[model samples]
Every structure is written in structure tokens, then in C-alpha cells.
Target: MSSNKVYVVGVGMTKFEKPGARDWDYPDMAREAGTKALEDAGLDYREIQQAYVGYVYGESTAGQRAVYELGMTGLPVVNVNNNCSTGSTALYLATQAIRGGLAECTLALGFEKMQPGSLGSTYDDREQPMMKHLLALAELQEFAMPPAPYMFGAAGKEHQERYGTTNEQFAKVGVKNHRHSVNNPYAQFQDVYTLEEVLASRQVYGPLTKLQCSPTSDGSGAVILASEAFVDQHGLGDQAVEIVGQSMVTDMQSTFDDKSAQSLVGKEMTRKAARDVYEQAGIGPDDIDVIELHDCFSANELLTYEALGLCGEGEAGKLIDNDDTTYGGRWVVNPSGGLISKGHPLGATGLAQCSELTWQLRGTADARQVESAAGSNGVALQHNIGLGGAVVVTAYKKP
Candidate 1:
């Protein structure tokens, strides 16, 4: 017997903003995002049988805190924290619950109220969760930059050494994402920059300028998921977007065995996850019309292009140079601006990607909608990864 199919019937998120720009807390963010998602789905809080909330920096039961403020439904709320991928991990759980017949309707919510500047540890007394990853990274190389930048930067540098990808090509990604953000009302940064401007910005790490990095942000995003039966019961076929296929893969031996920074920073994991998702969906990368990828840094975004099989290995630079990753290209990527401009609020980033993809698939993205999305034949792709480490790749199709 096959597992029941799951679908996303509603998705919503608050506009991402700089850390201090918002006068709101996580609960307030959750209240608005969750309420919007509930309204989008035409359902009440009481109708949600379960809730999975994701956050990185919060007290225990933060899930309960966020949801209770939305309404005292007293649902089985589960809190999740999986580094940057927390949002989609929550989403993964909700999809599983519905697919497993444990719940007919579920909510996956993610929120983060982050501090300004580059990320740092909140609790230093205990062992860092990424100590092992750092140890593995040390065996290969070390740089003066912080661990996050060093890992991803080292990966980019290695790609340059091996593939001859230029710093300008990487900057082009920042330019494209920022330009794309100009059409995205939810993006934190809407100002467009020329490729030269992007290249001249303050450097964050090797080949990555400040413009190429995703800033610490404050935001919340949520999605309502339901089973086919629930969709049929509620007559939600038109609003639903089927989770065509999904996969979550962790770091394999290649992360350490290959002794490559790219592998250490999640290239291999993303590769495996994308392959699994495509196989499950019975479709290839060429079938995808639009994408919301995890571009925490431009380097990752370019590397991801090759990892996702959008182009031949080491050809991502060429792909970007040819403008194949933007509008009027093979795929319209990061139409919501991706993390580089959309803002990455740890746990909230993944669900926000979901919101963007659902809108694109439904042809409801307004100004950001891709030309391919007009005929309602759009198939959206999502990629979200967190180092130390897990990667989730999902495919969505119009209902």
C-alpha cells in the first residue's frame, strides 16, 4: 500500500526585515504568519490537528508560545531546531504526519528574532554542536574568517581552484538576486546593484562580498499541510499544491573523505538530496520552471546549480554568465530573492521559501511570477540546507 499523498493548501510569511527594523517579537511574527496561513487555507485553528514550530534561539516550548498566542487550540505542538534547516524540518514532519495518517491537517511554522551582525553562539559554556564539523574542516584547511564564512568561503575558493570560476561570476549572483528582490515586496533588500557594485562591496570572505551574504534577519513563515482526503472534503483541489516529491539527506563520507571544502559545506548532501527528490518525482531538473534555492551565500547558490543537476559539474559559472538561472532563462531562480536578499532568519528561511514556491506554482506571485508560471504549468523546486548538516530538496506541482 502506498502512503497517502500530502499537499500544501496554504502558505504565508511576514516581510523580512533587518534585525532591529521590526518592533515585534517572535510571537507577534508567528501570530501574523500563522493567522495568514490559516486564513489562506480557509480553516480555523481548531481544524489543525497538529503543529510543528521551528526556531533556533528560543526557550523550550517556543512552539507552544507562538501557537498559543495565535489561539488556544491546545493542539499537539512540537518544537524543532535543526540549525538553518529547522523550518523545512518542521515542514517535513507535518508532511509525514499527514502522509502517515496520523493527522489530516497540520501546521508547520518557523520564526526567528535574531541579533544583528554575523551569527555567533548564544551559549559558549557547553560543547558546540558543530565542534565535529569544525574538527573535520580543520583537517582540510583553516582561514582567518569566522567558521560559517570560512567553511563556505573555503568551498568557493576551492571551486575557483578546481573549476576556474571567477569572483565576478559569483558577484553576478548577488546582482541577480538583488535585482530580483526589487520586484519582491517581502524581500529585506530591494535595491538593485550592478555587477561592478556587487564586486566592489566589502568582502566577507574569499570571493564573497557583504552583498553576497545573507544577513541575520527577523522574520516568520508558516504553511498549512493536508492530506488528499482533507483536501477533497474541503474542496480545496484548486488551492492545493502537491508535494510531488521530497528528500532530506545528511552529510555522507564524501564530506570528509574527499577532503574538499565544497563537500564539507554541503555540496555532496545537496547533490544526493536533489537526486533523490528528482527520482521520486519522476522528473529531472529540466522539468522545473522556477526555484527557491538556499543561497545563504552566492557561492553556495552557484555550487548548488551544479549540485542540483541544473548544469554539468563545474559549469555553474558558465550557467550564470549565460543568465540561465534568471528570468527568460531555463529557470527563474530565487524569484523571491533567495536568502541573499530575502533575508535568512535561521528557522524561518525554509518556510519562507515554501511560501514563495507555492505562490509561484499557483500563479499568484503577482509581479514576481515567472512567464512559465502563467499557463499554470509551472513546477516549482525548493532547496534548503543547514550545515552540520542536513539538506532538504522538494518538488511542487500545481494541483
Candidate 2:
């Protein structure tokens, strides 16, 4: 069956921050972002036919709460939680619903109010006996290998060794992102940092300094998607951002269980997504002008460069060193300052990436704007990776 055409009509986001001892909750943030998106799209909440909300820590029926804040509506509300990829998954679901003719207009909302504490530890669910057993096993295995590297940190080290990536090089990622963040009004870390400062910062894990890690942040981002017919009817044809390709893949749950550090799961899934997008949009990665990849850690970005075929294996370091990935350069990556500087509120990140890309495609990203390499026909790629590199890639095009 031919895939139904879907278009993103509007996108909105709340500033990323630490909440600053406020009473504002996830539903409030979600409603605010969603309302802004609807306004941007020149549509009303009543026009929305379906909604998907992404949240990791929000209460059950959080999707309903957010939509009800706008005004109690009868739209079907589905909640999604897929680790860090929740936002992207929500977007994927909304796109599918519209594309399948199940809905004319759908809203994908991602929000999170980060609780103070180490989020990584929250994965251990004491209620789940199996999860408790797994945690114990993980702890025992960790003790067996002295300084075995923290879960994600170990992956960074492995990539570092294979790619000859250095602490300074990783520091550069933080430096560049922090600098970019200064231009982003909504970014959590707006302060710029020099490479020396980043290098001197306290190390959290191996070569990764505190600045390289994403902070626990509270934020929300929303995107409104409509069928091609809806876009045409609303006189929003010119504002429509087409959904060209989308794919998601899951890998082995245990990071330690994987025989190889660099799993093809993400790579293959991204490739397949890219292929589907290329086939549908008649455009390839080479044709993409801007990209936003999950940079929960600096190494994740490096690995993604290779995994996304932006460069070959072991060549991502060179890409960063040469400044090929920064804004205004060839194929700008993370022009919105990325998770490192923009803040990663878990569930909000994926939709935030899409918001940034939509801004770029609309030529609204003032200082960080690319030269419109794709011209009026701009293309963007959003890449999100979950725990152990569960991957999703979505491609967008503006015609």
C-alpha cells in the first residue's frame, strides 16, 4: 500500500531549564508547548484529531491531562515511554496515524519535569523481581571488572579507543555545543566554555567531563502534523514539512551481552530508514542540509556520525576536528546546541530535535541558520538512540 503523505505544520518548545523550584508540572508544560504549536500552525486545539504524548516520569494518563488542559476533547490520547527515544517514537506514531488515514491532524507532545537525582539509577525497578535480579547481576558484573566504566560511559570508552578520540576532542564537543547554546535562548546551558575549561572540568567518567553530560532538565516540545489534504485545505501547503522516512529498531537489552561494542542494530536501522526516506522523497543523505542526532554524551554523537553514514567508521573524530559538523559548515549537526548544551529531558529530546529542524527548514533559526543548501527544498534528519543504542531515524523534506 502506498504510504499516505504527512506534513508537520508547526512546532513549539519550552525553554530547557532546571525548573528552579517551581510548581509548574509536565501537563502545564505540555499544554503550553502544544498551544504554541497550534498557534504557529494557525489551527485550534479542536482541530486536532489525535494526540500522542511522550513522557518518562509523568503520571499515568498524562497525555489526557495535557490535552485536557487545552480543553477537554475526545481525541484519542496515547502515552509513550521508550527511554530517551520516547519523543521520537511519539512522533513516529503520530505520523503513522496520519499517513494511514486514521487521523487528519495529530499532535505529538513530549514533556518531562526531571526529578532531582541520578536518572540512570531509576532504571532499576525494585518492584520488578526480574529487574531486581538484573540489577544485582549488573552490579556483580561491574564489581568483577574494576573500573569497568559506567553503563553509557563504557560505550564511550570503547568508541574512543577504536576511533582514537581524545579527552580534548571530546572536550571540543562540549565547547562547541556550549558556544552554540549561548545563541539559543531556550537552551539550559547558555554559558560558553573554552576547550581548556572543558578539559579542566571535573571528569564524570574517564575522558568525559561534567560539562559533556546532559543535565537533568525540565522541558517540553510539541509538533503538529497534518495530512497533505489538511495542509492544502488550511492554506498551509507552503509551511508543510513532509515526513519522508521513519524507522525504529530495538537491540539486545544488556549492553554487556553484546559481543561487539559497535552494534549494527542502530547502523542498519538508520540505513533502512534513510533508504525508505530516500525512496519516498527521492533524496539521499547527501541531499540533507541539516541533521539533529541524540548527543546525550559526546561519544554518542561521534558514533552517530559514522552510524548515519555521514562519514566512514573511525572517521567521525576527523569530522569533528575539521569542524565539518558544526552550523554553517557542510551538513550542520545539532544546530540547536544538542542535548549536551540544549539539555536532554529524556522524553522531550526527540521532539525538540524535530522542532529545531523545522525552524531551520522554515529559515527561522536566525544566528545558527545554514545557507539553505537544500534551497526551498530543504531536507532534515532526526536521529534518536535509546538505552544500548535502540535507534530511530526520521527524515523530513520541505518542497
Candidate 3:
């Protein structure tokens, strides 16, 4: 099947923040980000043919509420929830709509409000008590299913033994992200921490310090996608960021139920997604200049290096140690501080990653720009993984 072409015309995001003393709801953030996106695109809300809103824990008709707040005109709105990948998945849907000629222009919005007190068990199943019991047990065990030769802390221990991926090394990720967060006006955590400070912090998931985990945050991000024809018609051909490739994959849920650290399911799914994207775009990993991987945990980022084929298996530590993934390195990863430093508002994360890539491809990522090598067309990749190993990858190129 021939791939349909699409373009990203505008992207916007609100400053990620922990819900503070003031009363700011998810719709508030959504309107702010969505308005900013429309303004950035030099278009009005009326120009949008459709809207896709992604949220995980928001109330029913949350998208409608936001759209109403933004002066709704009865445009069709579809709400989507796909765990952490909600935002990126929404973007994918919008792209497909435009590519399939279903719509000339679409708005993709992702927003979330941090639910008070422990996120309130969205995974609970009232229909199947037995399944719910198993899920509860898994949660109590920190999502580890035993007797499968893989436990929750097994990977950490193995990493420690093999590559000396210490708790401190893991802590370093938090410290680095916080340091970068200090410069991000939109980041939730502005306070920077030292490596020693992170090491001294409280532990969350054993070897993974509190600082290493992303906090529940309130934020929103939006992107405007248009068909190639629409972009040309609007005289925005030069301003559009080409969607070179995109892919999505889902693994057997039973694989995660098995809880094997050696279960390459997540990695394998991401690899297949990347392969599909590369084939569609006629490019390879070597052509990508920047990347934003789902970094809900520091270890996840390490695993992504291999998943994206950036390095061989077990070489992620070396890549990080050599600073190969930093700004001036061969491939820059997570210059937006990632979820670790920027904060993860579940639904908003994936779109935020795409927004970061849009900036990088447009040469507008001030202070975190990666200088593309000679004859190298700047390319950026966004990777998002949802619950139970659902993966999506999107590739973009500077026009």
C-alpha cells in the first residue's frame, strides 16, 4: 500500500506544572495549548475540520468541555485514551484522517489533570473479579509476575552486575533531567538536583529513586496536521514539517503478564514499528538526527537505545557514558528533559514529544539544537509506549 503524505503545520504546549494552590482544570490547559497551536498555525479554530483529544484520567466528555471552552462550533470531537501513548496515538489518528482524505486539517490535543492521591486505580475491573484480583496482586508486587524467571528488580540487578548500571547511574538520569528542567519554562520541576542529592533521595521502585520517576503532572499539548495539498493551498508548503513515516504495534498482553525482564516484547514491537517507518520513509536509523523516547523511567530510556536500533544490545550504558545521546552527539535524545524532568501528564506526553521534535526539525529548539551534519537532512523521531507494551513511532523531516 502506498503511504499517504501528511504535514505538521503547528505545535503548542502549556508550561507543565504540578497542580498548584490555584484552581486550574484540564480543560483550561487544553484551551491554552489548543489556542496557541491555532495561532501558531496562523489559522482560526473554524479552519479545523476535526479534533482528536487524548486523555487518560479526565472526566467524561473532557474533550467536549475543552472545545466548548475554546468556543465550540459543533466540530466533531473524538476522545482517545491509550495510557501514556494517548497523545501520540491521537496525532497518529489525525494524520491518518488527513492522509485518507477524510479531512484536510485536524487538531490533535492531549491534556490531563493529576488526579489526587495515587491515581485512583483506573486499571480496576468491576466485571471480572478474578482478573481484578490478579491485577491487584501484580500491582502489589510492583507489576511483577513471579515464577517466570523475571522479577521486578531483576533487570536492575542484572544491569548492575553486567554494566555497572548503578542506582547512582540511574539517579544520574534524574539529576540530569532536573538540570535540564531548570531551563525549560514549560517543565514541571524547575528545581535542579545534584547527582549526590539524587542518590540521597528516597527510593521508589528499588534502585529507581523518586527523582528518577516522573511525577503526575497537569499539562497539555497540541499539534495541527494538514494534508500536503492543504499545506500547498495555504501557501505553507515551506513551513510544513513532512511526516516521513509512522508505525504502531501491539504485543500479546500475556507477554507482559509473564513478567520476564528478558521478554523482548516491548523492544521487539518498537523495532517493528521503526522498521515500518524506515521503510515507508526510505531512511534508516543513521539518518535520524534527534529522538524523543518514552522515558517514564530511566531504565526505559536505556532499553529504547537498543529498541530503536541506535546501538547493539547492552550498549546503552556505553552510549550514555560517552555522551553520544547528548546535544552535540551523533543523535540527540530527549532534549526536552523527557518525562523524568519535564513531567508526565499521561495523555499530554506523546504529543509533547512530537512538539519537541517539531521544534528540533524547524531549527527552533534554542539552547538544545542539534547541528545536523553536512548533506544530512535533519530528521527527528518520536517513540511512545503504552500500557502492556503498545508502541508507536513517528518520523519527521525538515521540509
Best TM-score goes to which candidate? 1
The best-first sequence of candidates by lDDT reads 1, 2, 3
Tens-digit lDDT track of model 1 for 66-139: 99977887789999998999999999989989888999999999999999988888898999977877788777
The list of candidate 1 runs beyond 4 A from truth reads none
lDDT of 3 by residue, 279-306 (tens): 9888888889888888777767776787
Tell me how far the alpha carbon of residue 203 in candidate 3 is from the true structure, in angstroms, after superposition.
1.0
In model 2, the runs with Cα more than 4 Å from the true position are: 21-23, 120-149, 252-258, 264-280
Residue-level lDDT of model 2, residues 316-339, one tens digit each, is 778888998886567888888999
How high is the lDDT of residue 339 in model 2?
Answer: 93
Q: What TM-score goes with each of the models?
A: 0.98, 0.90, 0.89
Query: Clashes in each model (backbone N, CA, C under 3 Å)?
Result: 0, 0, 0
RMSD of 1: 1.1
lDDT measured at residue 247 in model 1 versus the true structure, 0 to 100: 88
How far out, in Å, is residue 360 in model 2? 0.4
Q: What lDDT does candidate 1 reach at residue 323?
A: 95
In Å, residue 357's CA in model 1 sits off its true spot by 0.6
